[model samples]
Target: MSLTDDAHLPPGLALAWGAPAKSNRLGRKPTQSVEQIVDAALELADADGFAALSMPKLAQKIGLTANAIYRYVRSRDELLVLIGDAAWGAPPDRVADAPDWRAAAAIWTQAMVDRCDVHPWLCDLPIRGAPMTPNLLGWAEAILKVLTGAGLSPSEGLACALLLDGYARRIASARRDVRDSATTSVQPAAVTRFLEPRLQELGYSILASMMAGNEYSDEIHDADVTFGLDRILDGIDVLITQKRSSV
Candidate 1:
């Protein structure tokens, strides 16, 4: 949806796009810009976690009153949207240089993984719906461009985009969880030893063999990500083929 007026846009989208706030009571001009607020919010979220980044904490980080941020955003969810957009940044330029739609999609998805690596806190934000912020919409455009170029309709491309987005978030989230557990949980070797016996007794011969051979561990590998994305791309390719033939 095209939104030119700040009043029509959500608080977060407005803040992210630098839309002027709706006319309000005259008061002392705030010393901070929206960029400053988002920058400080990003730093705070990185130092702590997204959950710890309350408005009060953000205000303190920027040396403003607890209620000062209210002038910019109406609620915490709005601020979170702003933060998520900033974290996502811009889609990688390599996507445009990719040789094919499949390559473009792969680059786009890998960029997501790289961003998650930089800001592991990104996967923590609640999905409020489709992309609305400027940078995020840019990414949406990038992915959709490739998908449509491959012959899929806009609706089909969007569905495929959601598929890619879901995979990226799930892989990033699981990778983060595994890395966290590996730090505090029993050693992988110890866990493998404990589960191997149970696997054998449960009549799971294949799993038991893999465990005994140490084919599995707590390590989060990009191979699984590549595997999952390949399957998704294969499915999308099938759809593109079907749609192209019909056209």
Candidate 2:
């Protein structure tokens, strides 16, 4: 649903959009604001990952009883929504002097990647829906302006935005997974050695080749992310060209 659909918004969504503050009667007086609760939740998530952000744990972190935490947020889910909004903060500044939309779009996408790098836990948060939060919508608006200004239709521009966003999330998730796996006992070299013989026996020549070339190494580096992003942008350029040619 649209963020403006205030009449029937979920409690978490309403709070996120700054709906009238709800009265809290459970405690003597709340020492923490909703922003403070969200801030503490973000800090907890950053330090210990998203899995560690239960109500009891977070309440302990902020020196509140588990029930006292409910004074600010109705439930852990609402707190998660608030934490995500806080983590996103604000959109990156627009590139005013950029000569083309592609450059501007690249800047936008890179800003998202950098944000993910800072809060890698963001990659762990499941995307329940579209950009309802303010910062997220701001990011979307920035990119849409670039794409539509480049002569794409609104629908086309939105599609490209989704494409770029998916690419960034996938790359970030892959990198996070690789980093997490590195902490375990299994090593990439050992896995490659074990799989090579089986892959060759199964006649998966391409898989064997990649294994031999170290392409299956469990590391997602900056160059790999850049290559994928450039390819996506290149595809969008082709679409823009086709649209222009037909006009």
Candidate 3:
């Protein structure tokens, strides 16, 4: 029935959580459902971009008047909240069964990156704050559960989850930029090749050495993600180890 007693709750958010809404249709039974609306919005976003999603465009796509669409969703912002939750959907299953927290956390974080792969527009959504919606919070809870099980306190676990969340966001942002960049954009490897010979001529032997074997040159991809995960998880491991020692 009612999702919450608080009347201030936005209709779209309540509907996203499967909560009942304040019916506004006057003497007319609904012709469509919120799920259908959200699904169409998602398809529009996936095909175009998040910028193309608006009440008017969505209405045209779904055969509803611009104003009529408001009968299903309150506003553009509310629609975005629903889209985000839908985009994230749910966390990877069985992450909790991993042999260790570090392994589980790795699976969880990479899964976030993979989600962005499906919906590249996800990275464009401005993160107003921490995860609060059903699906997003489910992701956070999954990560926090693993970290807390590894002997981290609740606060410590939350902080670690934030770290992992930011890491995933950054990775997705980098991937999106590279994907959306101009065709003429120079990749790091190309730049490195261009700079290699000049680097030694400019008294930059160390720079030339790293670029000699392409060690310091490559496009951002899973390798970078693995490198970052290793360092971040290593730091967390140190903390967990210390907590274990003290206990």
Q: Which candidate is the best by lDDT?
A: 3
Pairs that collide, model 2? none
Give the per-residue lDDT of model 1 (tens digit) for 1-247: 3345644765577667676654434386867877788889899898887999999988988888887777666788888898889899999999999999999999999899889978899999988778888989999999999999989889999999999988898888888887766656467688878888898899998988888887766666778789889999999999998988887
lDDT of 2 by residue, 142-182 (tens): 88889998889989999999999888877877777767667
- Candidate 3, 1-247: lDDT as tens digits: 5434635664356777787545767546677788889999999999998998989999999898877888888789989989989999999996878898989999999998899989999988978777778998899899988999999999999999989888998898788887787476667677887899899999999879988877774358678899999999999999999999998
Preferred candidate (TM-score higher): 2 or 3:
3
Error of 1 at 57 (Å): 1.0
RMSD of each: 2.5, 3.3, 2.4
For residue 75, model 3's alpha carbon misses the true position, in angstroms, by 0.8
What TM-score does prediction 1 earn? 0.92
Q: Distance from true position, residue 202, model 3, in Å?
A: 3.5
> What lDDT does model 1 reach?
0.85
lDDT of each: 0.85, 0.82, 0.86
How do these models rank on TM-score, best leading? 1, 3, 2
